[model samples]
Target: MAIKVLVVDDEAAAIDVLKYYIDMTPTLSLLATFTDSRQAIQYCMLHDVDLLLCDIEMPLMNGLEVAEKQLGKTAVIFTTAHTNYAVKAFELNIVDYLVKPISYERFLQAISKYKEQFPTSVDDHFFVKTGTKGHLERINIADIIHVEGARNYVTIYHGTTQTITLLNLKDLEQRLPARDFLRIQKSSIVAIKHISGTKGGSVLLTNGNLVVIGPTYKEQVAKVINSKLIN
Candidate 1:
């Protein structure tokens, strides 16, 4: 089932842009859109909205109040032009914050957070923003060989393809199943199933790759590897 989405923004142009983005995403179903914050709150009374993409500043009522009304019931992602509201928005424990005008790539990143909140199936896969704007690529957990991070990006190597996503390595590690993936270093994580063996201080992957174990993570990695050893 597609994630039921509701869009609320005072500006018609902003609503239209969100509508276009919602249409392009394969897994999202736009339930309705509202220009008035009050009307949006009313619409939620009669419908089941999985995700709410709402603006912070509105005419009659601001988006923060709108979120307060739907708290606990609907997962929210704030779309606003202001940078000051970030601290307060996260206090509500919403999915993500999108600073407008939000690009399609950034929209995808927000959707990725929504997906994390409500997983489709057994948490088997997740979407990542690809090189192209307005495009998202789904990556399966079981297919991943190893992931390495540099700067603000992480490269996911799976099957024969490598996809670079704008995400911190630590953030990505949190999403991956702990049992399925091993954090061998600060900069890289190897799929436990794809790990062939450890060669000296390095972890060897099935596809002929060696990831040097970070000193900070060595003890934890050693403990995991030692547990699997057949004495």
Candidate 2:
């Protein structure tokens, strides 16, 4: 069955781009598109939608407000030009926050994240093929410490060993459990349980590796740090 999707954006151009992308994706079916936030909310209330592609700075009712109203009714993927709302968006447990002028590749990555978070069957592990040899290795999700992306490959640090796979950071981020991992920078995703400290825009891992939090990711990273801090 196709995943039902509803798009809400104040800009006609943004909505058009999203609609075009939705049409191209075989797994997603467009239920409706609205320029008005209130109308979008009304439609969602009357229909069953699996995903909501929304914009944050819309007039009348912003995307955050809409997501708040929908709550458990639909999963939200924020499509906006601003990065400021990211902290609040993640607080709502939305699927993904996509910055504006979203590339087709990134849009697809968001869909992959949604599928991973709401899979039909529970998955505790995933496999990654070894470099060149084509041997598939099973990896327990809980054993991962962090993943670091370099050039075209990502190093998965798990247990006492690390495996370098030919996968980008965005793709790897979607595969990991969102609640257990977070993208602190463009090139790094850290396991929440392995974070030892956060200070001066850097995350200290249990292994003593410090990952610098990117400027755009500060708020989202701070939320994680704040939640874990003992007061």
Candidate 3:
């Protein structure tokens, strides 16, 4: 399936460039374009947007406000001429930050990053390098319950066993299918299928282990829960 994309910018020219890029890329589909940030936010709230490309400096509502409003609903990539907001943008866990007059090459790179974080499909299994000799270990995605990040490495918990891999949590999060996994904390990513319930600020896995949801991620966890709640 093509990745659904939404472009938001006050400048007509910027929108045109983004549209052109989206058209040139076969993996992406343009869902909508917006010159007004508020209108864009409304559309996003009503649609299933996979990726969002927005400009930082706008007349009525800035891109930061839009991102804050639509947080956790979609992955965001900020495009602007200024470098002042780069730090803040990363803090929001934005996919990428592009300067104005974005080159086709750089734009493609950003899309690649998005693809890494939100894979198109989930595989039945994946391989991990193990031990000092770098032996390969095959792991079924279904067997994974949760992943805990410890500084430079992540411990992957499976059925009765755990595998420690020298990979950062954010990078590991990108490798897993977004639909099957949820990043509840800076150091934790859990398989959605294994999440039995949520208690207060923590997620209870089927294995009976509790993962504390970070304050920054609580809103996102709540949204996920609301979506799954049967009315």
Candidate 4:
């Protein structure tokens, strides 16, 4: 299903720009356009809108107020001329904030933020070519444990078997889902679910293997720990 979008801006130009962007994006579908915040809120409550591109300052209802009403029902991306509203708008757990006149590039950036927070399409499995002529193997994404890579080859470890492919770690890393995988070091990447524990500078996998975490990645590792474990 397409990600249903609703444009709620008092300005006709803003609404037109957003509508055009929504139409250009392959996954987005505009449900409706509203110059009135009240109507937008009412329609969203009665329907399903994946994202609400709303303006902050309006006659009856501001975007902040509109976001409050749509709290759990819909995700919001605020459009405003004032930078002052940025702090308050984020308090409502909105997807992104856009200051008009919103460039197409900036608009796409906000859409990317929405996509990352709410991933719509995730692959169940991916294919890799083997050394044999025209032989491709399907690797289940969930079964992945860890990956070890060298300059010329990448080795994937899943359950009890390992597969070596011609792709490097940098190339293979992009194929896996970011939410479920992490590049722990220069030469290795580990599946987040397969991590049993962490030592000083290493990750312990459930399969009884330890992978060293690179120095450059220690900050990201610390952040994950603070958000998911320590906090």
| Count of clashes, each model | 0, 0, 1, 0
Instruction: In angstroms, give how far residue 167 of model 2 lies from its true place.
Output: 1.0
Candidate 1 residue-wise lDDT at 57 = 91
TM-score winner, 1 or 2: 2
Worst 10 residues of 3 by lDDT: 170-179
Q: Which stretches of candidate 1 lie over 4 Å from their true place?
A: 122-231
- Ten-residue stretch with the least lDDT total in model 1: 170-179
Candidate 3 ranges beyond 4 A from true positions: 122-231
For model 3, how does the per-residue alpha-carbon lDDT over 1-231 read when each residue is reduced to its tens digit?
A: 568899999999999999987754545779999999999999988999999999999989999998898788889999999899999999999999999889876997899899889866645777787875868887787889999999988899999889998776655665566566777877888888898998877999999999999996687678677888998
Per-model CA lDDT versus the true structure:
0.86, 0.85, 0.85, 0.83
| Per-residue accuracy of model 1 over 1-231 as CA lDDT, tens digit each | 567899999999999999987754546778999999999999999998899999999999899999998999999999989999999999999999999889876897888888878876547888999889999999998899999999899999998888999987756765676557777776888888898998999998888998999996787688778889998
| Error at 143, model 2, angstroms | 0.7
Candidate 4 per-residue lDDT over residues 23-70, each given as its tens digit: 544456788999999999889878978999999989998889999998
